[model samples]
Target: MEINGVEIKDTYAEGFGIKVTRILVTAATEELAKIAATEATGYGTSVIGCPAEAGIDCFVPAEHTPDGRPGYAIMICQGGKKALDHELMERIGMCVLTAPTTAAFNLLESEDTLKTGNKLKFFGDGFEKECFIDGRKVHSIPIMSGDFLVESEFGYKDGVAGGNFFILAKDQMTGVKAAQAAVEAISKIESVITPFPGGMVASGSKVGSNKYSKFLNASTNEKMCVTLKDEVESDIRADADGVFEIVIDGVDEESVRSAMKSGIEAACAVDGVLEISAGNFDGKLGAYIINLHELF
Candidate 1:
């Protein structure tokens, strides 16, 4: 349970079953790949808050990319077919389609027919063109820099969503540093991504509301805030003064557990890190149960 001097909790992180699609964005260079990846994953934190939960999954070296440029893989998570389709349409249309010298492709190779590029083709205002590459249909949308290519549709598979961990530290700097280290670790792992803001969310939420409106499904956990430590149920360690949550989405429970284990190990190496814990709804989410201790 001890990673260096930091304590890893014996608790588990729970995740529910959701449909996931992998999006490959390729650019002319690493800088463009990073920018496109950031944009594609931007504005995507929570399903209710944003349209989907997405992040950069990995980077492909130039030799591996289609255009012989650096590329990034991103995972988009949604609850169902309709949500996934709709969100992908919006995100691809707005983010990937707008980026310069970039192309999008479906990570999944499936026979099931879907229409991702068919929906986004509207952005071309009828001037769009299509091509077949390796038997996959790709659409090209004219932009300022050049044409942006995207696959017709991405493959859909059931995946684990909402795998998360909290990094409690003695201060904001420590917490942020820990988070950065964790992101670096997670980025190296395949099939997992941190979708929250800056790969971390400070405002952790709990199930249901206390005094809020009936329509609200969840609200912020004020108790987790350092300022409210005196008035709320304190779960943070005594030496910890700040907290940040890392929310991960993965293709499966095992992938999530591996990513979490790697992330926690990297995060605990930093100074001022007190403990590593996870967010869960007990066993409500039956599909993915990531036991932190077992994972590490």
Candidate 2:
């Protein structure tokens, strides 16, 4: 298929099931809220090495927040309940809870939950208090800056992960422009996030290394690399000089499909985009085999 003169490869992106937690990080100022969110999501681009896959879903206005403060919607994704439990403690306690004038709230309505706040209230050294915020039960912990607020329980549910697409262009600048366009479009989407840095992966890698499988968990996609075009069985066209991959994780398969369609269309509108493609492990690696053609 051709979209805006750019070729769309008939392929699929492989993705597996995961647990997802959506949290509201609110603060006195928008900047502080964003800072806390960013910190909580740092080193969380991919699950291959990071403890979780996370990113800022969108910005919420003060009036829309539960505490009447500006905040950002952040999503943390893990392989299962156990890993998610550890991530929430580290990210929320060390990142959001430590930020100045910031408060964390669970946004998911899932019945399954974790007593994240109840676990962290120990930081108060036996002086923590139970409270209600806008009808939701919460815990107030005393901190050096002020009282830190966190919902008593945070909900989590099964989600989708590793849905991705590749953007091929004539040069790095063109590739970056196209990728940025895609990220901007995907940002408006709810219940989905592009976890890579700036929502774009410049150095996309495969599941494992061909030469040193035991030494590394992942290796560069040589076929997709511009520099190795001649040495390897290249995937890009002769004229294609740059390639970027965008990975989307969402609350469900439908949400991921919507994000892929929107992001691909937005990227195709940019000049010099050559083709759009996706990564897959022959349906051997993931629970979902999302076909690119099926998206449209």
Candidate 3:
């Protein structure tokens, strides 16, 4: 398939199942809310080495927030319930709770609930008080500035992870530019996280190693490397000089598909972008496979 004269390869992106939760961080102003949200999501790009994958979903105006203050919606993705709970406690306690005039609230309306500030209320040293805001249970913890408000529980749901695509270009600079455009486009999307540094992954990996240890978790995709085109079994064209990938984790298949489609469209509109493709470990690695050709 061709989009704006850019070739779309007949490949699919592999995605696995994960757990996702949404947290709303509110403050006196939008700037403060964003500061807390950005700090909470720091160092949370990919699960490869990070504890959790997270990103800012969007900014919520004061009217839409629980505390009648500006807020930001953030999503955190993890492998299981225990991991998600641990990550949320650590992130919110250290980041959002410490920020000035900041408060955290659970945005999910599901019947299922996970302990959020319920565990952190101990910092109040037996002085914490239970309160109700808009009929929702909230814990007011005493702090230096004033009372720190946090929700007792948060909501979580099953999600699809590891939705990825590749951008092959004529040169490294060209590939980087395409990836930047793709990231910018996907950043506006809701319920999805790119899970990589600046929303781009230069070290695309395959399942295992061709040599060395058999127990290796992952190895480089030499076939897609422009420098190793002649030495390895390559999928890169003779004119292609570099390739970069974008991996997305979303609440569902539809969200992931929408993110991928928008990202691909933005990347294809750039010059020197040769082809758009995706990464997949056959049909065995993930729960869902998003086909690139069918995205448009």
RMSD list, candidates in order: 2.1, 0.9, 1.5
Kindly list the per-residue Cα lDDT of model 1 for residues 1-296, writing each as its tens digit: 78898988889888888888888888888888779888878877888578788888988887876556789988888888888888788777878777778888787665543598887877888889988865778888787888888888788888888888999999989999999999889888998888887788888897777888587888977767788888888887667897999988888888888888888988999988999988887787556777888875
lDDT (C-alpha, whole model) for all candidates: 0.83, 0.95, 0.90
- Prediction 1 TM-score vs. true: 0.91
Error of 1 at 167 (Å): 1.5
Candidates arranged by lDDT, highest first = 2, 3, 1
Candidate 3 local lDDT, 1-296, one digit each (tens): 89888889998999999899989999988999999999999888767668999988788899888889999999899999999999999999999989999999998777777888899899999999999987879999999988899999999999998998999998999999999999999988888878777889999988778885567767888898888999998989888897999999888899999999999999999999999989988898887989998887
Ranked by lDDT, the better of candidates 1 and 3 is 3
TM-score computed on alpha carbons, candidate 3:
0.95
| Model 3 CA deviation exceeding 4 Å by range | none
State TM-scores per candidate. Answer: 0.91, 0.98, 0.95
Candidate 3 lDDT: 0.90
The candidate with the higher lDDT, 2 or 3, is: 2
Query: What's the C-alpha lDDT at position 273 in model 1?
Result: 93
Model 2 misplaced stretches (Cα beyond 4 Å): none
